[model samples]
Target: MYSLTLEQDNRATVSAAIHSDRLVVACLCAAWCGTCGSYRTSFETLASKHPDMVFLWVDIEDHADIVGDLDVDNFPTLLIQRHDTVAFFGTMLPDPAVADRMIQSIAELPDAELQRQAQSTAERRTWQSECNLRQLLNAPG
Candidate 1:
């Protein structure tokens, strides 16, 4: 799979996708995170399975500006966007069972759900260092 390596500063591109029809899976990771290292292959494999979607691996610590826009308090988080809107958001590596569930759930989501999810994500953009990290965690189900 041809996964994308985007600079943390590339919100223009991410935002542009929000105005299009493609799905975007942005993985927020840190270079030093062991979990991020372990999940690379699985992430790539999953990216291959969904070729129509754009898969991005972004290093949060390095791209603080872009990370600031995402309210990402965890090391390896997955934000799923469809039709330029976030439909599902969660944080678990590429566990096959979890991935399957995420795929199945997203496949059935309506545009209204996508819109609501997207708006909530956009509104929760606070990145203070002392902010409650638990606020950003989401389960696939």
Candidate 2:
């Protein structure tokens, strides 16, 4: 499946999937970004290749509440997570190959390893506290 844009229906899909064993790969971008526009096809193709993963296109401007105060200096920031463990979260180059590789590598890691790496780095620990999609998307109103 292609990367689903955030909407009411898709939000439910993501909400349920995040708690499952599936890997969640989200690209945080804005509609006005040229790079993001060009990169959309590549991102979808990557998603098609990995059907087991849940890929999302989150427009920060449109979904600011879900995004909250997350730091997004660049156009295409990536947030890769499985359950409560945020495997990766940061700005990425617009290249789809890089994202594909990252997803493959992270998916291969054992849950314990992911949990370790999540807290292993200061940056990653920050992701756990600040950039977690599970927490951000499911926050109480």
Candidate 3:
């Protein structure tokens, strides 16, 4: 499975992927962050394990237009979404195992429950607005 590293040249591919029905797993990082660089391999490995999902590596500084409004307080922040629902969005540890487990647990949840949680709290609702990859990609500049 190929993991997409979002860049100016690949914006079209990333945008296309975001419009799909599959779950999107995005790693929000910065190009200059050492931790983010070190964690890239692990993130790709995790993506390899999940062939059905769409994995994206987004450099916050490089693609500021897409993720500038997102409050990514730490390196390697994660955003997981499916369709219009932002299932999870927060700072994640650098450990790939933790990410794997979190993905598994979230993917296991019923769609109805996930949709409910997407709107159950204000923070989660904010994800719908700020962390939705499709919305960000399609947003007007």
Candidate 4:
């Protein structure tokens, strides 16, 4: 598993995985949120199931420099991506089953399809521009 719990000590390694071609499933949360705390275990189990992909646990407060502009209005937001396409980005229910289903559904779509959807609607368009994780990771810190 190219999986990582993002932290200051391993920024470069996690950044490299984010830049890779593999599907990136990032759970954007805050350490202080009770819901986030409860959801942590499920997120890890999900990561273990998808060893082929890169699963990242991002504490928004800890990695604000990268995910701050994400405008997270809720706890346990999910950023699902494939290459340059931001397939899905939004607050998901804290249900691991739902998150797992999402990973499968999104990862099944082709990049061209994902890109098309990103531009298909106003909300999705915003995601393409604002929620692109790779772009966020590449931003100057």
lDDT of 2 at 110: 95
The local lDDT score (0 to 100) that residue 118 gets in candidate 3 is 90
Candidate 4, position 58, lDDT:
93
lDDT of 4 by residue, 27-135 (tens): 9999999999999999989988998899999999988898887889897999998887788888999999999998998888887888888789998888888898878
**Highest-scoring model, TM-score:** 3
Relative to the true structure, candidate 4 reaches a TM of 0.94
lDDT of 3 by residue, 1-141 (tens): 757989788888988987887788999998899999999999999999998899999989988998999999998899999887899889999999999999998888889999998999999988888788898988887
Clashing pairs in 3: none
- Model 4 residue-pair collision total: 0
Q: What is the model-wide C-alpha lDDT for candidate 3?
A: 0.90
Please provide, for model 1 over 46-128, each residue's C-alpha lDDT reduced to its tens digit, 9 standing for 90 to 100. Answer: 77887766677778777664454565556568776565355555566447557657865775678787566555644432221
Please list the C-alpha lDDT of all candidates, in the order they appear: 0.59, 0.87, 0.90, 0.88
Ranking by lDDT: 3, 4, 2, 1
What is the TM-score of each predicted model, taking all chains together?
Answer: 0.67, 0.93, 0.96, 0.94
Model 2 ranges with Cα > 4 A deviation: 8-10
lDDT tens digits, residue span 61-115, model 2: 9889899599998978999998888998888999888888999999999999989
* Model 4 / residue 135 / CA error / Å: 1.5
Question: Which residue pairs collide, candidate 4?
Answer: none
State the TM-score for model 3: 0.96
Best by lDDT: 3
